[model samples]
Target: MRYVDFTSEELWKQFLPGDHLALDTIVKRHYNLLYQYGCKFTRDAALVKDCIQDLFLYLWHRRNTINETASVEHYLMKALRRRLARALSKSGSMEGIGFLEFKDVAASPDEQLIQQEQKAALADKIKKCILQLSRRQQEIIYLRFYLNASAADIADIMQLNRQSVYNLLNDALNKLRQHTGAYFKPAMALSIILLLVLSQL
Candidate 1:
């Protein structure tokens, strides 16, 4: 079986039957996205690492219950989001964003060094901004983007009405706009802002 050639759903089916190769292939393909997202939620790289490791372990141990419709990324994100929520609730802040302190958004060897520097600076500022939001704002951001929850899915995840999730997401953006600063380029500013929002959530 060419597990590498399989779709997420196909790998999932094989994995359900206790196929370790299929399970391993699925994890290898999606680990980067999961790790990056894991970095976003907590100050402790160890905690994020543990969460991802544990999540995949649980998947292997309980593959039979895995949802057929969920893509590999969705399952990982959903589990990670739940883990982050638990972590945030315990730590009492989302952007205790300490892991990779964004202190030096400085010039790089790359010719677009200045652009990269500004982007990093914006990301730093956005990270601080995430710490300022209410807990509800943080949770909403998690479900909406990192979890890739649709408005309906977010509403379900967060136990809000559909319109409420929409309103909260817009409000979070408005708050972030005020945080990233007025002089920043809007497009670059927003991309980094959303990154911060997703991370802290």
Candidate 2:
């Protein structure tokens, strides 16, 4: 049968009925988005890939029992987020070991060198900033920017109200700005931003 581009609900109907094509499309649609979010959650490419693989397999096995959700993207992300968070919590992996498989990052020698330097700087800042975040806050940020999730979508996925997601994001961004004021160029301005963000949160 020819595959059709159907709404998520239709896709779910097909999926639960064991339509292999539907399952294929579902995986293709969300794989990259899911993987990127997974990477942000744990910074380990392999683990994230493993987690995604496990998730897809679990979904395949349980499709008959899976209920329809308004947004499949949100559901997959939520499931992936929960799994990654649980894995991280259980392992507490802090050994500076990377989990991502930066595929053939082919670049000119100069470009590669510049990329490495930038990556190192960003990594340092991220490590410091991440350590300052509450677990909930960290999850929110990861879901929002990394997964490109909308506030409404995230609120649904995270089981929080829309206002709560905004508040959490605001509070987390403020904390990060305060802690990383050194990079923000002006301590006074950064402080003001913090106060504003805190107020919003």
> TM-score per candidate, in order?
0.62, 0.60
RMSD of each: 5.4, 8.9
Which residues of candidate 2, in runs, are more than 4 Å off? 92-142, 145-148, 172-201
Model 1 scores a C-alpha lDDT of 0.66
* Predicted structure 1: clash tally: 1
Which candidate tops TM-score? 1
Candidate 1: deviation at residue 196, Å? 7.0
Q: Against the unseen true structure, what C-alpha lDDT does each candidate score? A: 0.66, 0.66
Q: Clashing residue pairs, candidate 1?
A: 40-199
